[model samples]
Target: MTPTVIPIDTPGLGDRTYLAHDGAVALVVDPQRDFDRVLAAADEAGVRITHVFETHIHNDYVTGGLALAEAVGAQYLVNADDPVAFERTPVRDGDVVPVGDHMRVRVVHTPGHTHTHLSFALSADGEPVAVFTGGSLLFGSTGRPDLLGPDHTDALVHAQWHSAQRLAQELPDTTEVFPTHGFGSFCSATQSEASASTIGDEKRSNPALTQDEEAYVAELLAGLEEFPAYYAQMGPANSAGPGAPDLSDPELADPAELRRRIDAGEWVVDLRTRSAFAAGHLAGSVNFGIDGQFITYLGWILPYDATVTLLGETPEQVAQAQRDMVRIGMDPAAMATGKPEEWADGAPLGSFPVTDFAGLAQELRENPDAERVVLDVRRPAEFDSGHIAGAVNVPVHAVLAHLESIPHQQLWVHCAGGYRASVVASILAARGHDVVAIDDSYDESAGAAGLELV
Candidate 1:
């Protein structure tokens, strides 16, 4: 009988954890810091978790491997060469561990995402079932080689190429490919739309398998862009063995406390929808709407060690954001749940104009000399592909650092969609800059609105 594999997706983080079981016993892979989800999964599956595995010391989110293992008394497996501070059952290349009666795992040393990375190939009795390629071999891409830094990038890219080839050559073509990253993850060298794939599918579509090593490395390096700044802290936190998250309600803040924190240069983030925030919000509050990829962009642009106070329409929204934050090793300093009017305590709420690309085109046509600046907040590559003529390009992730360079005139901000544009616009508005957020789809709205794209 084949072991059943259940994917536990953290879509906001663009990662997945696996709960694979042979009916009676189970093993977990690459769990997030909030390990309660894994425990819930185990309970639903009706299996005792007997083992936990780590593919590498992650660079994106704090790992819950040690904590989860200890909670269930499961043997934790990590690479023997990881140099971690915690105790674990360290296994090496070519080592095979039996899991229950029907499943067995063969460890393959597949380095590249990190020096000590390992991929586990699972078999049911004697038949290959699946391979957990944490960050090594993805669906149509590979894990980025530069996360370890520039000094190791060159050698690591080469290693990544070979590691991908090794997996292709060793695993059966029918083996299901279960990767931890690549669904909108910055860890992927490039993104893949395919949610599931087999070794044969990757061998045909993946650059590492189709192109020469030289070509693959050059393309991969050229395409790399800035990842979240918060990534610098994840590996160390995981290495030290992260504890469970503190999901208890944060201390409630009153209107005056919110004002004080804002005046003190702390981040007062609004978690309402972008439109709701634009309609009315506390002055000096930035919008990272809960409806969008809230955690990813917030983690990217947030200044390290800055105190954060979350403002939401309800307590549940704030609670969900808190869970997302702890996965990236952050805890909110305080929280408030109410409308901006309620939080303002009779003070006037601040707001700005929200329009679509068509409205922007009309404004430009109607008042060509209005002293407005159209800002493209998409990534550099997206800007290069196509953008409004004369628009300034500043990727949303780097907007804070490039604030000095942004034109002081009235600004119209946009991204592929509107989420990032709202982020940049709200940041500028909080800083007292004249801003307008283009809440429209760039591809559909730009051309339909008769805007000139260069």
Candidate 2:
């Protein structure tokens, strides 16, 4: 019988955790720090978790393999050569481990995304079923190789090319490919539109399979962009073995206390809709809205050692943000729930005007002589492709450090969509800048607005 594969998606971080079972027993692959989800899946499937596997010491998020294994009393399998601090059942290339009655997993050292990366090929009753390619061969692309710093990047990319080829040549074309990255994860060398694929599909579409190694390497390296700054902390946390996240209700902060934290330079984040945040929020509380790429940007921009106090509209919203926080080994120092008014007590809330690309276009047309600053907060590549003429380019991630570069005039901020622009606008608004967030799609609205695009 073929094992059932259940993919637990963490879309905020663009990663997936797999729970595969063959009737009575289950095996988990590349689980996030929240392992309770894996336990729940196993319980629902009526199977016992007997093994946990790690693809590599992940550079994206803290792994739950060690915690999950210890919780379920399962054998935790990690690369034998990994310099990890915790005890695990060391696995190496060519090792085949039987799982219950129908499944057998063969470990293949794929070594591209990381030096000791391994992909597990699963089979049932001697027939190939699937391969879990974590941070190695992706659905239509390959995992990026530069996360190990610049020195190892060259060697890793070459290894990644060979690893993808080996999987393509060795695995049967019919075998299903379940990769942990490539679902909008920065870990992918490039993004793919495919949700699911087979080795046959990848062989035709994956660059590593179709292009010469040098060509693939050149393209992949050139395409690499900035990843989350939080990633620098992930590898060490995973190597040290992460524990299960604390999802208990955080200590509630009073209005005065919230003000104190903000004054003390602690990150008091507002997790609301960009519009809701723009309309009104506590002064000095920056927005990383729950409705958008909240975790990714928050993890990227937040200082490594900064104390974070989350403010959400409801207990559920704060709980969700807290779960996201722990994946990166961060925990909210405190929380404040309900409306911004309640959090502010009687203090006047801070706010800024929000507009669309059309509004911006009209503003430019009406006041051609006005010294208005149109800030494009998208990546440099995005700005280079096509951007508003005369707009200042400052990627949202770097805005905090490059504030001086921005003029102290009326500022209009926009990103590919409105999410990132809202983040930057909130930050600038809190710093006493007259900012307007353009809360609209850049593609659908920018060109239509008749603004000059360079």
Candidate 3:
């Protein structure tokens, strides 16, 4: 019988958790941040996950391999060449990892996306079946060569070329290829809408494999998009285990006790949705919505030096928030207890006033020449679709470091919805900027307010 393969999607972020099962034992691959959902899926499956493998040092989000390993008592594995500071069993090329009586995985070192990228070949009952390509090769395109150093682009191109050829020549043509990242991920230069591909199909259809090494290098080097400025900082955080919290936890603390903890230097993170957060939030708490790429934003705004206590509505939300923090190397001493309203003595972080189209129109009209800077904190694609006329694009993930460039005048920010805008508003407020967060409806009111986009 064929072994079962189960894929679990992490909510908000697009990372995946895979389980390759052979009756009693299972292997999990690339369990990055946003792990609560992944954990639940594994529990439901009732398979004993014995090994956790990381494809590479992740840049876009935190890795959940450590936490998952700890939770399930599994051995964590990464490429032998990786410089991860955490303890992990080093896997190298051709080493077989047994999953059960009839299933095994062979690690193949395929470095190009990073200095330490790995792919795994699966064999069931002594027959080769699939390869977990990780970031080395995707459905439509190869992993970006620019992730390493620009100086090593040529070498990386050659490595990747040889790597693809090796897999194509060595692994059976029938082998299914599963990659860690897909479309919308920053890791790959090009990705298909479809998630998985077969080795035979990739050999015939992948553009990167058809080009000569030099040509491939040239194509990859030309005009790669600027990565989020926050990406550079994330690698190091992942390297060092989450450091000591800059603040104390208040999860068990009552309203007064929570305030005392904050007074003693703990920072509160409001993880509610933007609409819920905007309607009412703790006055000084930064509003990073719990949904949709929350960990990436958390890494961007939450200072490594601060202790972070979460303000979440549900238990699952709270666990997710905690796991996200841990994945990115932010170990909070403790979380705050009770609801936002309960923390009476804690000072308000800042007001994230949720505005409808009309409210934004009135605000824009009232502040005609007051140096009001309208910041559109959406992705490049979203910004292209009709934004507030004159709004400068500074994606929320890249906002904190570039704050010096933002004029110190009054700032108005909006995202597709109120969520990201609130996160940006809180970030600016923390930096002492006067900011007003507008909901997605800002664009609808822009025409009525007579605001024009350039």
State the C-alpha lDDT per candidate.
Answer: 0.93, 0.93, 0.72
Q: Tens digits of per-residue lDDT for model 3 on 371-412?
A: 778788887757876777778999877786687898887878
Clashes of 1: 0
Assess candidate 3 and give its lDDT.
Answer: 0.72
* TM-score for predicted model 1 compared with the true structure: 0.97
1 or 3, greater by lDDT: 1
- The lDDT, on a scale of 0 to 1, for candidate 1 is 0.93
Please write out the lDDT profile of model 1 over residues 306-393, one tens digit for every residue.
7999999999999999999989989999999988988889998989999999999999999999998999999888899989999999
Judging by lDDT, tell me the better candidate of 2 and 3.
2
The true-versus-predicted C-alpha distance at residue 237 of model 2, in Å, is: 0.6
Question: What are the per-residue Cα lDDT tens digits for candidate 2 across 83-202?
Answer: 999999999999999999889999999998999999999999999989999999898899999999999999999999999999988999999999999888889889888889999999
TM-score to true structure, per model:
0.97, 0.99, 0.78
Q: What is the lDDT of residue 164 in candidate 1?
A: 96
Residue 364 error, candidate 2, Å: 0.9
Mark the regions of model 2 whose C-alpha exceeds 4 Å error after superposition: none
Q: Locate the minimum summed-lDDT window of 10 residues in model 2.
A: 297-306
